[model samples]
Target chain A: MSHDKPAWYERARKGPFVGNSFDARARQAIEKRIAGKGDPRRRKSAAVATWLVGAAAVLLAVFIVVRLQDAVPSAPSGNHPVVGAGTEGSGKNEGISAAVVRAEGTAETGKLQVVPLNGEKQETLGAASCMGKETDMQFQGSYRVVYTRGKESGVVIDELPEMTFIQPSADIVQMTKLAFADADVFLLVPQYADCHGLNFYAYAVDKNGGEAFPLSFRMADGTESNASYYPPGELPAVRDGQLVLPSGEGPGGETANGPQDRIFDLNLSEKALVQSPAAMAGDVTGDSGKKALTRSFVFSGQTYTIPYPGDYAEYFVHAAEANLFQIKAGTKKKLTSFQEDEKGIHYVKDGRTFTAVPSIF
Target chain B: MEHEFLKHMTTMDDASLRDIMAQYGSDIWNYAYFLTKNRELADDVTQDVFIKAYYRIETFRGQSSLKTWLLTITRNTAFRYRRSTFFRKVNLFASITSIQSGRSAETEYMEDRYVDDIWDVIMKLPDQYREVLVLDIRYELSTEEMAKLLNIATGTVKSRLHRAREKVEQNLKEVRS
Candidate 1:
């Protein structure tokens, strides 16, 4: 082994620029901490005492809450109506039919509440065990697929009145909802292995309570490819009902014209992925063709772009300022603060408040 | 200079904290990123690490270098993030592109394909192996220092380093073949 470090290692040592926004945010947090409770360095003993008291208070609160919950009469099994389930007047819940809500307890012990968007009707849809706090739900027609990310991540598929949880392979990290065929919902599962890179797998879940199975793809040479492994960052694109993946080297040695894309039509009925014609790849609209919904506004000579119809806790990035502001329901705050009250959305800059209008791009 | 910095760390004010962040922020951020493989989590971990360092500055015994101490905190903080169920929502594959930034255009263009491939292999290693390899190769930490930072024995560190290098070599061979 060489004692001297490689040139690449030296280059890697410099690391990525964390950006000025991060520094600003860190400084802001420190300032906030200092302003709130005085300098952290000066309050070591006080901080410890405060932490102990806080912990005790939290324990007492939890005990009282648990006792109070036990004192209340339990609702009969099945559809348990939740309090404050209706969002009739809430403008945000306009078209959403139903939503998966975290129940009263912690994630490990709680049950997910499937509450109607505009009605008081709610159903207790299984335990929240193995479900991550951060969940991505996709509404496909009437089928609702909730993909959770965590240590023991799994998917919750709700076909209206009935719901089922499917635990994917331990290696699978992400699950993207793909086009469905009949009663089967197809999901693109990306599994990562050490040194082996990421491999894309197709999973078909039957809404009629049938077990979910991995779908194998028929390669161009009539061989079945269980999964196509691609290097990190080279994810396969799903378009129309076909999966367009970059092809590896074939039996005929290296291709003089670079790697071609192998498109596979999802045949859920056959329970297998069949190879489609190469021209089909060109027929579907690529990712670049689809426009992302974004909203932008200028504040203090810097333009900030955020995702449109922004969700709670979504970050708004100001490139020039290198600052990130988190969006709440009606207000954007953190780092550089932007508040939206009854009057209008206000942007505070250098002891001055300016009203700003929101526009979509 | 490090001793002076450590001495001042105990009495670190807002300006001192800002100065410390400026000096060691990228290093902490990069280490956190390397461990967690998520940029957003890395940002959070970096901020948390500095805040933690500021709050717990009196505990700095000066046994390790200031950078190592910061990195040790960074590793622990990153591990805490990894263990947290909330922060585990990050897509690992998508985060691979994050490490490619902060390089000069000339440096990027002049980089050899072999070098890029090697780094790619290094990045894709399992967390345990990658941590050891990065500490050894990138941070240039001694085995003893790495063991201390990782909370493992020196022998274990050496073994993991061997396995990490072996895995990298194996992956590189596969890539080349």
Candidate 2:
């Protein structure tokens, strides 16, 4: 095995050892198949018959399309009324009849043409570009959230005559409902960023419309900042009306005490996310236990890590004014001063102070 | 060896067929397991691949290596099984049973800690990335061969390989740390 190759590659190359029993079974099945006992090949006549049936089906489809085209007259080019429109008060959205119209100049983009089920005039919404072939629309109270899945996936909200398009910084993977204290419904949208992995965004939906924002958490420095958690198989869950964000690592690489779950209390009245008192109590161990320090933050989408000077356990108690080093690529560069706050990690290099959220991983 | 195998494939008897299976059965089974992520399905798909290969040997035009051709058949057979309703029902039942058992075929096979960690990371990746990594690392296929096998552009294969490697490296670092 080459040193450059990942450790798993060698084991994978060897592959799984499907033993003598598998070989015996496979050989028996193959022999039976060759002897024309297992799934015998179709006869030449049957094969020809199947081909003829397929061809007839295609010809019939073409004929039907031609006849339909001749029977139905084409409407005027712009703002044409769609045929077979759904009846009033039908579908998931009651009293709202909507049709997806392909954009005039583009083949991949489309617009949502909303027509009231009560015989109201049809109105055209904003451009709802679909990255993939399929577009999904869901309702949160009266508001409709249209999600387009693909490369440049985005969400569009239809608020009657107006449409609000929300394009997150990264590709949106999925959108789910987040339980909030207020009457307004919030969507927990997870977006996939190449550099940062997966980050969740919270979108608030109200009678006025809907707006997208990142989930914020109060850091160790007693300041509120946008927070992102990496939850792979599991999603953020709500327990007792509190949002529990499970992270793989603590604020920093302080896993000696095991992983930490950050719980947040959503305070819509102050429009701020406050860490729950119970969670805060769990963080501090009466100064006698190990202090789990956070030296990591997620900026933009990527994570950057700031390494400790030496042994973290020894450095925690004795080292106070030691120089900090930031690892870039494989090399570590010295920093004048490093500070961890709610906003991000602030460091001084070449007489300049810069703030960054070093990646915990 | 592939040339010799192909030369005898037309006039292949029971002995030749058994030789062929003996030589490539594990590869086909592993490839099927990688695609379906189920041991039982892998067994069925591997058997089906060989049977299909036996019947379709005349259609093989020597465009690619015999192993690549067999792998391609394995991929298609595994995907067909996945698309079948029977496979879905079985998958659901298997998921429940596995949950109850608290152990999987993967855990049984990969006992080494580092190998198990790597397998976990690879399994967590999206299907597209995982497929490319398995083909490149385990099968040792060229980018062109992978593109041909996946029905994608060579550029797409390269980009996927790059991203897959990056993700694996990053995840491995996290696991080790």
Candidate 3:
């Protein structure tokens, strides 16, 4: 990704625009005033009046915000009321409760292996520092070895500072701790065998011991076939689930679509593979769990592995929107390495390699 | 209150529209400047982007990043300026009244010696390559993002970027020689 050019990203950190602050001010001012000013229809005209100033400012500004709007608000969030949809569903408890709830299966979490993306995978000290600080460090069982860094308020999977998260396997065998921290959250990612294409599906075997119906991608080609994945089921691949496109409004307000969506939430029980990056900071760990412990180990001059659950699940590192990489657990996080994203600054560590950490499942 | 929402203060109540300005006004302005090399023209393009962003906010599905969406609108607006009679009128106006002022700005800028050599190389590139070069370099968007922003294919983005980079590299070598 390097070249003679400034990498198309330096444009953002360039000189700030002359009129940015004022435009932001004007924007906030107008949006606030229009909050209940009748139809909010007339706001457009007033917006036109203040357009020039904001326009001038943005050309030189870097102060930015990326808060998601309350479109179809589930509950009264951060501030604004539910927007686009969720009018009737507003008062009721929604989200996780509404999505399909799966039974708790104590499947023996399998072993984990990490493979280098390419070339000779090297290790460094920061990764070592990350593991040294992990709590309840054990050497075995249902734990994960992640590639992270020391504490410095990290970013989540889809949130800012997107870090790469790759599932470790026998082919991808390697090791490193994501970062050192009191265990906090887990981030879910779609498992990919290669860069070809990715999707998750499931099928069944009938009395004839043959592959029955399957849920595959709705590709343009007339014929359909299972290309990569299989989910857990024997019913129509899709039905009640809503296809929530990028437009925010879900088809029938049911499903969700995002590149960084959690695979765990789809059908896994309370332990959905796709977690929202949780935290143990000031939070309760419930009375029914094993000693609040995380397994730990080392590799290639770097300490790696944290045994959390008796499952073969571990947080991987990656950058989402900002194109910056870091480690995330549940809802909590630890900053790891980063490379230059389009934004201000990013770091590079071995160009997309998937390293290993010990797994206890 | 590290970053309070700004749309509240303005008549621009469209959340997506304000998000557009907040997210990518800088990018649009830079793109406009890359095209016209004129601050005023860039300003015009920026204004058009938000206005359009405001009107079409509803059409925005979360499919693309906000930055990509804004750039698409800005590109269209800048192209519109090139086609409109308003451009001719404004250019003629500046030519008639600000000829002396234009010369003055040029002299002052030259004294600073900020040669836009890169943009010049970009300007010399074929339009297909030039567009990708400017968007990729100026906006820093990924190849995939640039394709989505321009409503083109990723392969197109890669192809144009390759040709554009070669052109720039050739230009740089020539300059060095």
Candidate 4:
């Protein structure tokens, strides 16, 4: 008997075990559910639940759109509160301990809402003409909001010494939500293609958008292309004080027959972006389909991958797992999962309710 | 030939439905597991797939094979499960569910280890890569069939499948090294 089939093939041979027990249980549940569709009593409860969810979705959508429309225009003039750290203005004064409500908005020449990082309320920070241009708004850190405005070319820092920085001539077609390696970070195209084809640029700004710094790097062949930069999948972010972005070969950042794709870590503090060892950054953007690159964040020196609205990082505590440790150090242990309840984000470890980090405002 | 089975599906009685489930239930469950990488959720999703198929049987045009149509449902159901708030909140059991049928302890252990390792690698792959692998490797669908199923160009499917395989090989190499 030959047993040396590939591991993957063997695994597929084993397949998922749909034993009689699971099948019977599933059959009963499905039968009941299907039967409930005909029974008026069961239908009532199902209809109520469906209606509630649908209503909530509609209300939330309407609320967000209304708020975005309100925030689009300039707020009746004068120094509108640019909500950020060290700014004491009319906005709600709160601390990082406040509940991180998912406050996001889309922008054009219209309004931009400063979603209350501190409260459940959506605060219209101010409005701008944005030259009748629109862009998506993403919350950075606990307070700052990163937005794109129309006709304006530079990578602008709203709450900064020079609001408009890295004023590249071309328009930004797509930008991802801000990922924080530390506090203040630069906005740049990690990988992008203009109508003219593969384009690349390195942009950087100091913490708090205080100063703009030049960012640069050499390709795998040790050559620099100024015509454009191809950042690959998602834009690079500062993780653990390291500016990490995906790097691949060929002109368009596509992985050709030659060298494999890797992640480059640039140190902004050194004022030069240098490629880190392949082992340190690994392949941040997995295959061309761009899976595997979960948003990884370092909290208390431990790196944890979290889904969108990464504010959940505050609740996770380190736990040990072999897979978690192999890829990177300080991975907020895998066993420590989370579930959000009415109280706030609750952390579960080893199938037990280990600790709860309430949304304390 | 399979169209006969699908054609009669609209009028299929509970006995016929059970027969259909008996024939295809395992296939559906396996496909769902490969897509979701969660055996328990796959179990629930499999049931939902069957239930949905039973209800929507009349809508079957038989343009695709019954298996392919069922699998499309399985993929959609699994993805919907992933997007649901329930999925977001629940971290159900991570271990693979075992069949009630008897298997020697040694056999089960070896199979579990292999499956777990392979799945660990597969799950790390992005959704598109994972989808093609599951569809091609598990279901043995051809490139043309996959192109039709995914509603993408045959060229795109071929390239994506190539890239997906390369990624899987690359990942395996990384682990071994």
The count of residue-pair clashes in candidate 2 stands at: 2
lDDT of 1 by residue, B53-150 (tens): 77766445565677887897787676556534232353333222222345587755553232334556777776668889888876778876775575
lDDT of 4 by residue, A275-342 (tens): 44333244344333333222233433444453211222223422222232232424565442544345
Q: Each model: TM-score of chain B?
A: 0.79, 0.81, 0.70, 0.78
Give lDDT tens digits, candidate 2, residues B1-177: 464456334334667668779888777877887787776677678878888777646435465777887887887676556644222342212222211133367754542233344677776666668889888887888866775576443554665676787898898889889
DockQ of each: 0.04, 0.07, 0.04, 0.06
lDDT of 1 by residue, A8-93 (tens): 46644543332332445555655666468544553565455545555665565456334433432344432332334335442222
**Candidate 4: CAPRI quality band:** incorrect
Mark the regions of model 3 whose C-alpha exceeds 4 Å error after superposition.
A1-361, B1-11, B14-23, B85-116
lDDT-based ranking? 1, 2, 4, 3
Reference-based TM-score, model 4: 0.40
Q: DockQ for the candidate 3 complex?
A: 0.04
TM-score of each: 0.35, 0.38, 0.32, 0.40
Please report, as a residue range, the 10-residue window in candidate 4 chain A with the lowest summed lDDT: A160-169
Compose the digit string of candidate 3's lDDT tens values, residues A1-361: 2355544334323432333322453344335444544324444543553454445444422121111111112232223221122223323221111111010011112111111111111111121121222111111111111111222111111110111222221122122111112111211222322221222322121212211222222211111222222211211122123211111111222223212211111211121222112232123443322233333333223433433332221222113322223343333443454222323223323353323343335
Using TM-score as the measure, the top candidate is 4
Interface RMSD of each: 17.6, 16.8, 14.6, 13.3
lDDT of 3 by residue, B37-89 (tens): 55555655666666655644433333455566567666667655653322233
Model 2: pairs clashing at backbone N, Cα or C within 3 Å: A304-A358, A304-A359
Cα lDDT, all candidates:
0.49, 0.48, 0.35, 0.45
Name the regions of candidate 1 deviating beyond 4 angstroms: A1-11, A14-361, B3-5, B86-117
State the DockQ, from 0 to 1, for candidate 2. Answer: 0.07
CA error at residue B116 for candidate 1, angstroms: 4.0
